[model samples]
Target: MFMSRLRRRMGRLAAGVLALAALEGTCTALAQQMPAMPVTVANPVSRKITESIEFTGRFQAWPQVNITSRVTGYLDKSSFVEGSLVKEGDVLFSIDPRPFQAAVDQAAAQVKITQTRIDLTKANLARAEALKKTGNVTDATYQANLQAYQEAAASIDSASAALATAKLDLNYATITAPISGRITRQLVSRGNLVVANSTSPLVSIVAVDPIYFYFDLDEASYLAYQRASKRKMDAGDAEPALKAEIGLSDEKALSHQGTLDYLAPQVDAQTGTVTARAKVANADGFLTSGLFGRIRITIGEPYEALVVPDVAVGQSSQGRYVIVVGADKIANIRPVELGPKFGSFRVIKSGLKPEDQVLINGQMRARPGGEVVPQPTKLDVPETLVPDPN
Candidate 1:
């Protein structure tokens, strides 16, 4: 009975070991047959992009004027309200005209007195000429009469000049705006004495519309712009107008467009930079002088380039990179050199080919060497890109 029990126990132990081996083999097969993680991929989109450089800049009023008194007098009244927009030629301030008008009247009376003196001198000279011709007058007497007539004529000319000057002084008493712009507060109050040719300004005005923008470009950027301009002219095209885009500090992108109208005659030796200026229309008067902003200027012509959406580009310890799926359906991280942004897409300066498949979605499931099932799709690019106000 003891020998039979031992034989049954041995048989049961062998069967249990064989069942465990079959179960392990079945799990290995199931793992091998599993499908790859699905991911969305697209080829780099071809687009026309231009190379550009950006700089920090500020907005300035195109023409700013300081209002001052041309003639000395007491301030009579002001025609404009403080902090108001004034039209060109609108009256701004009025100096006391009573004093200037009185001076003009005095000058006019002096001119009349000189005219009366000239008549008397003419009559005496004529009588002297007749008496001399008849030998009734002495030669010395006739000579004196002639000299008197000449002196009277000269006196009248002097008096006439004084009258003209007085009239000009009278007109200057009424000050007018030299330009259309917003004016500052009056520095001198009514009934206060104001002096002529004073360094102090009574008020200030700044033209806000069609504002000017000033920026400095590095030496390298200046040279590149010159080269690109020359190439454009050589191609029988108009010299490429150096255009600029501007953005305020709060803005995300440059949107306001302007033309680079003026460049400094020479570069600054100390700064090693060239000064550039641009003009932008500000009819709404939103942009103001002394406001700091960013500016961007294109230095190259448009050319075909490979681009990918900004979100697809990733940052890592190595640098900027993108995940590219190869022919073997394996995801590989590619390090790429990046260029300026072109709308929502980023310009890939290098390390990307137009034919390479880039994974755009399901990045979390992707590993550097992991296999993936890529879903091919077309990249939709906008027909027109809105101007970026730098």
Candidate 2:
């Protein structure tokens, strides 16, 4: 009877242990099947947006002048400070005046001497005329006196002209600024001999207060711009009325605004591009010549476009893409076409629908063909891409 009881107890314990093990196995299986990862998603914001194009360009001074001496002489002194603002008619440099003054004096003395000679000849001619009336002078003597008088008159005129020329030379000895602008350092210092009409410049001046920005537009873009403006190359308007903006190398926003004032008459065959120019105001003298900048111009009319934050876009070996969640709560990869950036938002050309939910956050945890718990949200879109003045 004891052996039978022990056997029954062992069997009951074995069955109970098997049942416990099965219960634990079922719990482990349930734990392995986890819920979907949560992610933040939002529908793309649709709005009327004007497309803009950007190109690398440089700042240029429209009226740059190279200062040079008009008369050959030793440079006496420079009147203006280097790198200083100068106005029209301001004395820039002065050549030695001693030689010019001496020339003027000599010309004036020559004029006086010619006048004295003319006076003496006039007296002699009067005497000859009186002698001729009295039959005391021959015809040849009278003719000779008249000729002398005429020669003296001619000599006086020549001397007077020489005096005027000398005065002009003296005036040119003092060099003056031709235009109002910022002047560069003096290349020819004081006491240096400078030749007239030389290619070497004494200094250079550039107008900064209405600077110019120059860039090149590809042939295709040139055609598109012409069509958008409704103006052809043969049109009477040389400058299109398009507006342009510029951003410096270290800048993000194109804060400098200007008008498209110049365009090349023909496309360059070698470069396949057309040169374009803009005029921008530089009241503070911030824009400088030869500085590399980025120029932006609106290409076409405003159209409706879907946009999302730039962070939402992802890059892959193929190209740019975005993760979108569908109705079934599954993440899918959608290839995207990108346009210019508007502040922090990026324009999506295609491959995205207005109603599709794009993953903006927790992108790392999301994968294509994976289940996700999407948290719906909205994007803050700006009315205009322009930065606030404040």
TM-score against truth, every candidate: 0.79, 0.69
274-332 per-residue lDDT for model 2 (tens digits): 99998999987888899999888888778888989889999999999999999999999
lDDT of each: 0.88, 0.89
Per-residue accuracy of model 1 over 1-390 as CA lDDT, tens digit each: 998999999899899889988988998787556668899999998877777788898999969899899999999999999988888999998998998899999999999999998999999999999999899999999999999999999999999999999999999999999999889888888999999989999999999788999999889988998898788788887746778888899998788999887878899999999998889888878888999998888888887778888888999998999999999999999999987776788878899999999998889878788789999998897754443333
For model 1, state the Cα shift of residue 378 in Å.
1.9
Q: List the pairs of residues colliding in candidate 1.
A: 246-389, 246-390, 247-390, 254-388, 254-389, 254-390, 255-388, 255-389, 256-389
What lDDT is reached at residue 263 by model 1?
Answer: 78
Question: RMSD of candidate 2 to the true fold?
Answer: 9.4
Return the top candidate by TM-score.
Answer: 1
